[model samples]
Target: MLLLFIPIGIMVHLAEQLGKMQDNEAPFNEIMVYLGNFSITIGNILLPIFLFLSVIFFTSKLASNTEIVAILSSGISYNRFLRPYLIGATFVAVFMFFMGMFIVPNASIGFNEFQFKYLKKGRQDRVTENIFNQLNERDFIYVSRFDPVRQIGYNFTMEHFDENNVMEYKLSAANIRWVPSDTLYRLTSYVKRSIKGEKEIVETKRRLDTIFPFQINDLTPVSYIAETKNLFELNTFIEDQKRKGASNINSYILVKYKRWSLPITAFILTLIAVAVSAQKRRGGMGVNLAFGILVAFIYIFFDRVFGTLAEQSGFSPLLAVIVPNLLFGFLAFYLLKQAKR
Candidate 1:
């Protein structure tokens, strides 16, 4: 199923992205990397649905053959008959926990970077205008505009305050560009003003190559930055961004919550699938498969809606991850009761 499904997904994506890739003359080797990352990201996202549908398919077949009836008739309680399925679900949940936490984030880096570099050339994936960040309690920075691809910001200002919230010095620059080769920041038209005793001491320079407390990415990270960090890195990154008072912090927290929620989702969908398909019916596997697909789409819909709300609005990210799983958990319980009867 993976061989067939993954190839089809790649074909569809390649069709849509081929024009942009060709126009940008994307290298064949780098394109291969993107396709590999695509496989990892897409497959991981679809893992729970695949598990649900596969279980329903096989279980429905067994039900049609009276295999499930034999097990129940042979003095095994319904709950005991469910033990193996539960064990299998436990294994899958653990596997998915590790995959979502450790493996997929690296693929996201390759995938998203290639997307912005080739298909979305000249379009910034990060915030690019009127950026502001509080580096620490006493230091703040601002920029009138930024160009992510060029790694430069215009009309940059850095201000420092004393313990009493009094202005100590202010630094302004016409432009700030990261000099990657030199490992330093180049500030053009640099000027500094020191305030003391109601007098201002001014200093100016044509250009200055120096270091600041913050990195370029600290200004406003790429929209998908959180998706590119592993579990450990993501937690640390979130805390750092929070300290900096990043305005889009919710989006990062949403990623963290979703990763943590995948295991619970696996268990919920597994139970629901077993409950729905373990009993023989007139329509057989076809009916079970169709219903499975419908439920899968509904799950996807709820997840997307809540995720968008959390990322765009002020809705809680934790609730966004939890609410859908809770709804499905209730459905599983109802279906399990009906199936037992």
Candidate 2:
């Protein structure tokens, strides 16, 4: 089922993106690489839904063949029957834990970077205009326009303040560019002003090479940066962003919480699949499969609704993740009880 669905998904995606690929003149090999990464990312996202349906299909078949009834009639308890399924779920949950924490983040980076670089025409990947940043307690930076690819900023200013909150010195440049090899910054049309005892001292230079405390990317924030980092990187990034008081800290927190919740999702989905299809109904496997699809869609919808609320408003990110699992946990418990009886 996974194999059949993957190709169909790729074909549908390729059809939708073909025009954009051609219009951008994207190379054949790079496009193929993007699609390969896309497959991994999409598969991880859809793994639970497919697993649920597959379980329902096979379990329903066992019921229809009387295999389950025969085993139960032989005095095997329902709890004993569920041992292997639960063990399988444990293995899958472990796999999901590693896949989400370590592997999928790389695929996410490649997928989103390729998307912003070539696919999103006339769209900016990072903020490039009227950007203001506080580098530290006493330092502030501004840029009129920034080019992330070139690592350059235009009309840049950095202001430094003294302990009393009075301006100590102000620096401005027509343009600033980072030199990767030399590990220095080049500033054009540079000017500096220093205030000492009400006397302003001015300095001017046509060009200057110096080091600054902040990175060039600091001028323009990447909107999808949180999705690109692996476990350790994301942890460090969240801590640093918190220190910097980032306005979108909630979004980063949401990503972190969601990654940690994937294992829990695997368990809940597996139990729900087993309980829902372990019985022979009038409609056979068709009814079980149809119900699986409905439940899978609802689970995804519930998750995304709370995720949006957490990221957009003041809702707790932890609560957003837990609520869906908690509700589904109740459903799984009720279904299992009915199946046992």
Candidate 3:
């Protein structure tokens, strides 16, 4: 793990430095901060890859030395020989799960902050456009555009409904700005129309102070908001975003489901490594390593393809997360069956 991790980390660090150097104004403190964040992010991303390589490398060595053959020749079942590898994989999966669920989310927060603060200075937070969603059981809201930095929205409209789904009142504003000091909203050119059975009551004001069920935070969310939240926090966030009819809700759901799915990948990869490298090959460890890399690349390709489908095309997020695992799981079983023969 250290051997692979160190070189990968150094390469990433150097790439970041080269990019920053092109700007010719890389601050020493900023670079230092980025280095710390880069290391953690790299470690988290590469942990499973390193574990897969380690299993294949060592197991191939054992097969080459006839150790596996010796054990099998003693009448011990193939399944029995796999116990230790399974146990080790289980331990690795647990550690990875904990990191993915708790530790890495916080690290991602810092890593993304550093990137936005220094690397992506001009990019704006993701502000919802054409925002139309249910504010609650009794209210629905719409806005044409929202300025995240200003905590304001333009061309805002809201509707209040009765229990029978009858429109009771409608509110319109040329602009709405959050007043943080008062914890309320100020609407400019506000207009309200109330319907009372067969009568209509209209009110107009140049400016109005009021409160709503939603807040400015709901108007603009960072792109990596899902990445920086733990499992429970992610669940709560997804629910809140869903209520707001967020277009990027699938992205958040993808992240939440992937937290559990990624850990299971360790076990699946371990099985494939053991199965593929258990037999003595004429080309030795090189052949095993090459095959392992090919399988890993394909697995990653599937994961990215399906995840993109979920994020952009409204595919099922849960299935997007599990499809790669399912494909590789079948590959593992097939390889194991051939290895036993």
Candidate 4:
């Protein structure tokens, strides 16, 4: 696995470097940093593929050499023969689950940060443009533009409503800048209007410093914010974003659900690989390998297609993660039955 992946990874990285070097866009130091980050992130994603192929490659060799035949001839059931494969798959599954739940989030954050800073200078945080989102049960906010790098917003408005959904007060500002030193916002050209039944009282200020319920993060959420958070943090973030009426909440939810699904996929791939390679064939290990590669690519294709559908459309996130697994699991079962026969 390492033999195959390391060369491919390095070649791809070097190709990227060649392009960036010709343009003089990235420094050698940044290239090194990116190489490290890219390798780790890519490795995590590729682990299941490597494991699946490993099972097929070794198991095919065993079958070709008649080792599996010898073991099964001793009156051992195919399910019994599956015990060691299950054990190996369980080990890989647990490791992958833990990595996705904890380790990969940090790596992803760093990798994306480096990419945005050096490789993708034009990248902007995906905070909703001209956002009009619920701040709370009785409050809402609107911002025409939020500059994530500057931590500032232009044309900000906050409205507080009564239980009857009537506006109680409305605050408007030409600009709002985060005062990190004091942990408040400095609102320029601020105006507040309070509605008391039929009367309205107005207050105006050239500049006002005040604290609002919303934080800087609420204004400028990067698209990959969900990828940076661990499982617990991601759940908390999703809940908070849901409360805020975040537009990209579905994508966040998808990321959270996929952590579990991908690990389960590892197990399913193992099953399919073992089932496909367990029977000795005249075509030998090469045919089994080719078949395994085809199945692996098909699995990835289904995963990406369903995942994109869930992200772009109104499809269920849970179902997006589960559908590919279910389809391939049925394939695994059928193949295993045939192998047993």
Candidate 5:
């Protein structure tokens, strides 16, 4: 565990330096502060998994070396030997779950802010493909592409509907910009047409300013766009979108569920580790280590696959987040049963 963290520390330092180079700015002390906080946050997030692996690796070696057999011959059941491991894993799992759900989210705000200032370097200030935002209770906006440098949107469309679910007005524009001074967004080089009672009124405008309830921060950034929000922020964002009547919220919902599920992976993997390596095999420590790594890789792969599906499909995010744990829990149970026999 001590050695594992050394590489993480090195990576954080390298990331900070890389940020400074990109922005042409001196390395700020604040960056180090954020890095330290972020590292701790990440460590907490991964601690359960580490604890699980540590328990399995050490205990498995003891069992392979005949220590477990000696203990079993002394009239102790294998389940009795698991008390310490389960206690430790439980503690770590609870810690990781709480930290991931409550603590890391807020810390990420600072972490991301530091990265944006020193590393991202105005890259996020611009908007790009598939921009979506909620305007009001009955209004929403979607744009195919936006160029912040030019303050123009390509294929911009705003939809407004009445309380009765009837289409009230729809506006399309080739380009749009925010007139900061007056707190208005101006659509330019565009045609404005409104439909009412099977009649359409079409007009051409050089510029039109309208009041909209969107801030720069309200726009999503391309990086860390998924699952970077804290519990409060995520809840608030969801409520805001719901109020604005936005349809798709599957991604955000998945992120919320994953915060709790990820920590439990540690405990489940630990059980699997102990079950896999408990038997005295001639292949020795090398074999146990290889098996451990393979299992870990498989677990990570399943996590990524489910995460991708949750975001893309209309599947329940809660189900997607918990499915890996559920599947592995069954595996662990099966292994434990086999080892006992």
Candidate 6:
């Protein structure tokens, strides 16, 4: 298994570096940094799958060598042999679940930043013409133009509405820029107006810098805004987007659910592998490996199909994310029963 994975790892690493080089963006040192970070990210993502495949390969080899027969003859049930495997698989599943839910999200942010800088040529973070985002239940922000290159926003406006759905306060500025020294934003040519009941008040300032409690990363373009938020962040963002009446949150919702579902796939696919390869057949491991690959491919295909449908159609994100797992889980159980007989 190590022999098999070593070449695969080398290939993946080389491909990642080569792809970055082709982009002509980052220097070799920066590219190496990005490659290292990405390798760790992908490794975390694929570890459970690799472990599942390893179990199947080793278990099938043992069976092919008649070791399984020896154990069976010694009065040990097949189910008993599965105890250790189950324990190991459970550990892997739990580890993967937590990593996917927490660690991967944070790593993804750095990985994506690296990609944006070195491979995407900074295109990923670009914010162009007028952008509007509903920041909260009663507040919305608008920017006429934002230049990511300059890290500045122009013609910015923030409107705060009261519970009665009436605009209570409005702030407009000619420009806003992050003042890293103070860890706040500085707004220039700013005008602040307030209307309460029948009274109106206005305030103007040449330059105003305030500590905006929220990070810029926390606002606007809620979805596809940042790749570095954990499940908790993603859920919060999804709810915020939904509350803001955003229409393109389906994909994010699908991803949020799919993160939980993907780890369960290890158990489902492992069961399928055991069922397909448990009985000693005239055909060798090649046949079993081929069958495993085929099943894995089919599962992946349907997963993509459902995911795309969820985004394009009216399908529920939860169902779309989990249906493949459910279908294959049932199939695995059926095959396991057949193999037992």
TM of each candidate vs. truth = 0.96, 0.90, 0.92, 0.94, 0.77, 0.81
lDDT (Cα, 0-100) at 338 in candidate 2: 93
Extract clashing residue pairs from model 1: none
Query: How high is the lDDT of residue 84 in model 2?
Result: 85
Give the winner by TM-score: 1
Which is the better candidate, 4 or 5, if ranked by TM-score? 4
lDDT score of residue 108 within candidate 1: 95
Candidates' lDDT values, in order? 0.93, 0.89, 0.86, 0.86, 0.72, 0.75
Across 259-309, the per-residue lDDT of candidate 5 in tens digits comes to 767657777877887888788888877787787777777877887798788
Clashes of 5: 0
Q: Candidate 4 — which residues are off by over 4 angstroms? A: 21-30
lDDT of 1 by residue, 14-54 (tens): 99999999999999999999999999999999999989998
* Winning model by lDDT: 1
Error of 2 at 256 (Å): 1.2
What's every prediction's RMSD, in angstroms? 1.4, 2.4, 2.2, 1.8, 4.0, 3.5
Q: Model 2, range 29-113, lDDT digits (tens) per residue? A: 9889899889888888888787788788889999999899999999999989988888988888888778878888889888987
Tens digits of lDDT, candidate 6, 223-319: 3443466877888877877876655678778878878886788788777777777777787777777777777678768888998999888899999
Q: CA lDDT of 336 in candidate 6?
A: 82
Please list all clashing residue pairs in model 2, or write none if there are none: none
Residues forming the 10-long window of minimal summed lDDT in candidate 1: 212-221
Candidate number with the higher TM-score (5 or 6): 6
Clashes per candidate, residues 3 or more apart or on different chains? 0, 0, 0, 0, 0, 0
Model 3 regions more than 4 Å off? 21-30
